[model samples]
Target: MHVFYTPDLGDNEFYSLNEEESKHCAKVLRLSIGDKIQLIDGRGGFFEAEIISAGKRRVDLKILSRQLAYKKQYHFIHIGIAPTKNIDRLSWFLEKCTEIGIDEISTFICDRSERKILKEERLDKIITAAVKQSLKAYHPQLNNAVRYKDFIQQDFTKYNGNLFIAHCEQDSQKLFLGDLAQPNQSYLVLIGPEGDFSSEEITLAKSYGFKPITLGESRLRTETAGVAACFELNYINR
Candidate 1:
């Protein structure tokens, strides 16, 4: 069954699909009236519906049933990374991470960041497509890009979980993120740019209570490191 993204789906008996989704259903899939389809509200709501009408611009469906999907047993995963020098790399990371499972993503501009500006609108589309393709019931939050200092200074008093920063700087006491992160605890990990974080930036993060951590022995690019941290968190919970 083809699943569609309909975040605003509520108590209504019938729901209309957006233009992009409608075209995919009517023209590409050739779905007709009375065909069964699945809908996700991106907040854990799932619905089984039958197409009442199929048109290129709009598709109406009569919902047959609604159910809430299983929520993540572990705490939410929040990854903050510097935008990659190449935009495609960051987009790829977003897709793969969404497929695996991520609660939130934040991009920060670091001192060594090669790319400061980001196209969040395009990134949001990539995340939406990934969620649909992976059959996720919830959509991950994508935060707007901000400077590193501003990001760290924001109030995180409500967050009662692990805070970590992954950097290339040599620190003999640094431990693997998998070892430091406990199960069923919220996590916020930071990954630096290709040029890595400046010494002063790392110092500032440490002062803010961000524990220094290591992804692995081998160094990785900004996007790779972000995905690696995300996968490690998921693996630990599983």
Candidate 2:
């Protein structure tokens, strides 16, 4: 079944679809009256509705049943990384990470990062598509790309979670992610770019209470590391 995300959904109600969604339902999918579809509110709410009117400009549906589905809460995994130089690769990471259940994403401009700038508008579309594709009930938060120093200084008070910085540099307390994750606690995993975080950058992270951790033995790309961290957290939680 095709899942469409509608955050405005309420209990046992009907809603008129947006222009874009209407076009897709009326023209692309050619959905007619009485056709059934699923709607997720991205807040653990799912609605089963039947199309009442499949207008080209406005598609309307009447809600038949609405149920609340519990979302993943074992841990909140936030992956902070430098966006790959290739936008496509970064987009791929966003899609896969959302599917695997990442809570938040922060992009930093590290000293060794090849790409320093990114467009949030484009990234947001990719995230939206991913959320719908995965039938997710919550949208992962995405932060704008910022300087490495500025990124580290933000108030982590919102995150009462485990903090980890995944770096390639040699560290005495390097532990695999599987060994560190604890059930039901929020987690934050930081990943660097292809060039990796500079020594000074790593030191700064450590000073800011970010624990140094290792993902695996082999070297990985920025996108790969992000996806790996996301999947690892989800797998452990599951």
Candidate 3:
């Protein structure tokens, strides 16, 4: 069954599905009255519904079953990364990370960051598609671009879990993610841009208690490293 993203979802409430979603359901899928479809509110709620009215412009469904999702026993992976030099590369990272069930994402403008401004509208579309494709119930939250200093300065009080910063600086402690990460806790990892984090920026991150970690022996591109870190944490807990 094809899953649809419906933010206005509610129990026993009739929602006129969005035009694009309705078109896919009614025209593309050729679904009719009484057909079953799955709906997610992108907020940890899942619903099994049966179509009440099937139209070209809208599809109405009655909620047949509802499930309140539980938080997974895996770390809530949050990646603070430098945007890739290319917009497409950054967009690809967003899509893959969402599919792997990232909790949140924050992009920062580092001294070496080549791309600063991001297109949130397009990123939202990619996230929505990834959510549906991955069969995930909640959409990952995306934060607007923030400066490196401001981003690091924000209180990480809620993030009681471990924090890591992947840097290429010499003599920095090499952290094995296996030893640092655990299941069911919030985790944050920082990936630097093309030229890497400046020494001063690294010092600030260390002062903020973000332990320096290395991805592996071979260096990775900004986008690749971000996705790699996301999957590494996700797999460990799953």
In model 2, which range of ten residues has the least summed lDDT?
A: 67-76
lDDT of 3 at 35: 88
Q: What is the per-residue lDDT of model 1 for residues 82-143, given as tens digits with 9 covering 90 to 100?
A: 99989999999999999999999999999988898988999999999999899888899999
Model 2 stretches with alpha carbons more than 4 Å out: 158-161
lDDT of each: 0.90, 0.85, 0.86
Name the TM-score of candidate 1.
0.96
Best by TM-score: 1
Ranking by TM-score: 1, 2, 3
Q: TM-scores across all candidates?
A: 0.96, 0.95, 0.94
**Comparison by TM-score, 2 against 3, better one:** 2
Weakest ten-residue segment in model 1 by summed lDDT: 67-76
**Count of steric clashes across candidates, in order:** 0, 1, 0
Predictions: Cα RMSD each: 1.2, 1.5, 1.6
Q: Mark the regions of model 1 whose C-alpha exceeds 4 Å error after superposition.
A: none
